[model samples]
Target: MVNETMVTFQGWIGTDVTDRYVGEAVVASFRVASTPRKYNKLANGWVDGETNWYTVNAWRSLGRNCMEALKKGDAVVVHGRLSTQVYEDEEKRRFQTMVVEATSVGHDLNKGTSFFTKTTVGAGGEADDGALREFNAELGIGGPQISSDGQALGDFVTDEPSKEPAA
Candidate 1:
């Protein structure tokens, strides 16, 4: 069975992303809203049609980037695998959440300008033999010996927050 569906969209982020550790895995989640806008001949301006919202799930370092880079109302581009999450509330009503397992996300330059840097994970495009490793070395992303407990005498439990990708 072939059930995977790939989707790509450009829109505005509807929420702030916070990255957290979920059992040794870094995860970040946020929402992206897309609406079809067209010129309204009667009003002579752009008119928005119905808005569609999708929950974006970014994993690992890409997830970390989203946490540091994005905020509500920032225009962005996202690409992912489409999936649905079904759940029931205390009232016994079932709801299906539209979700996208985001593989790539970036600022929509059409709306505004932004800065970008290749991540330690990868270059995001086709690989060309050791390029990603070299990029990571330049940025100092993956390094050794930063124990959380030892850093602040067992008070600090998490790594330092990241600040990049201006909103």
Candidate 2:
């Protein structure tokens, strides 16, 4: 039998990322706060309610990216598996904590622009592809055209020069 689970949460960063070096690699960890709304029939229709906080850890490149781009109050969507562990504090208090091991993390649309609708344009200016590019060409939203080669956008996080091979 195969045991697999996927969980998603929308939340805001609780604090700044704390990154440290473990040998030659770096690990980044942070806390996120998620709030759920509940309907109250007493004297009001709905009220902002309880908030759930979770610790999130990102490994390697993802950790670096999260550390650089994420900050307090920034909204993000984290997708990954849930993990739990037991710990003993300095006071000898035993506690169990749940954390999420995020395999993929990204910015929330409500907070800022996401990579979902990302696009680029070519000199022909007719839109690289009708299916891919959505915004109007007149808007000048698209950047340089992406080559047909294996130059994936994931390889470049910034506007650096692309090293695309010949098709």
Choose the strongest candidate by TM-score.
Answer: 1
Least accurate 10 contiguous residues by lDDT in model 2 = 133-142
Instruction: Summarize candidate 1's per-residue lDDT along 92-132 as a digit string, tens digits.
Output: 99999889989999999999999875444434532233653
Residue 163 in model 2: lDDT? 54
* lDDT (10s digit) by residue, model 2, range 37-79: 7888895788877888888988766676677678888899998
Candidate 1 differs from the real structure by a C-alpha RMSD in angstroms, to one decimal, of: 14.7
C-alpha RMSD of each candidate structure in angstroms: 14.7, 11.6
How well does candidate 1 match the true structure in TM-score terms? 0.65
> Which residue pairs in candidate 1 have backbone atoms (N, alpha carbon, C) closer than 3 angstroms, thus clashing?
none
List where candidate 1 sits over 4 angstroms from the true fold: 39-45, 121-167
Task: Give the range of the ten consecutive residues with the poorest summed lDDT in model 1.
Answer: 145-154
Q: Candidate 1 at residue 138, lDDT?
A: 61
